[model samples]
Structures are given as structure tokens and as C-alpha cells.
Target: MFGSLGLPELLILLAIVVLIFGVNKLPKLGKGLGEGIRNFKSSVRTEEKTASDENGQDATKDANNT
Candidate 1:
């Protein structure tokens, strides 16, 4: 999707962000965003694993019941 954004477009976007957030706060903003994304991804992985484990257990229970 982002393949269409060339250097000029990226630079313009970056400029807009810098103007809005200022250079001094960029690092803090980036760190927070990175941490939020990491936490979200970790939770998603844990949830998927839990769902798969539940499904596996259910399948075995059904087979034994029959």
C-alpha cells in the first residue's frame, strides 16, 4: 500500500509531523508509539495461542465423549 509513497511524499509527511510535534518531542512520541504497538502485538499473539489451545482441548473432549 505504501509503495506509492515516493521520496517527495515521504519528506512532505515527515515535514508536517515535525512541524506539528517539534523535534524535541519526536523521540518520546516514537518511543511511546513503539511500546504501544509492541504491547498490542504481544497481546494478540497470546490471545491466538489461547484460542488454539482451547480448540484443541475441545476437539479431544468431543472425540472422547463419542
Candidate 2:
């Protein structure tokens, strides 16, 4: 596993990325990545909320029937 990369290793990786993608594209790539992660997190939160609501309804029904 990648233990924390030291500063030199980090700079090397960054240099490679810049070479591959070019400096101008890096900002666009970073923005897209940020948006993707944000959307993923929001979707996960929504699914969790829906699941919890369904569980609550089931529990209430069981309690009423008892």
C-alpha cells in the first residue's frame, strides 16, 4: 500500500501528471473530480434517508399490530 508519500515522491507524481495531462487541463480535471465526489456523497445520503424512513414505517406497523 502507498504509505504516505514523502514530499519528493509527491512532487514526482505531480510532475508526471502534469506531463501527461498538461497544466491547463489539471484545473478542469480537478473540478470534475470534485463534482463527481460531491454527487456521489449526496446520492449516498439520499439512499440512507430513504432506507431509514422505510425502516421506521415497518417498526410503527409492527408496534401497532402488537
Question: Against the unseen true structure, what C-alpha lDDT does each candidate score?
Answer: 0.99, 0.97
Residue range 42-61, candidate 2, lDDT tens digits: 99999999999999999999
- Displacement of residue 45 (Cα, Å) in model 1 is 0.4
Among these predictions, the greatest TM-score belongs to 1
Candidate 1 C-alpha lDDT tens digits along 7-45: 999999999999999999999999999999999999999
Mind sharing the TM-score for model 2?
0.86
- Once model 2 is optimally superposed onto the true structure by TM-score, how far is the C-alpha of residue 37 displaced, in angstroms? 0.4
What lDDT is obtained when candidate 2 is compared to the true structure? 0.97
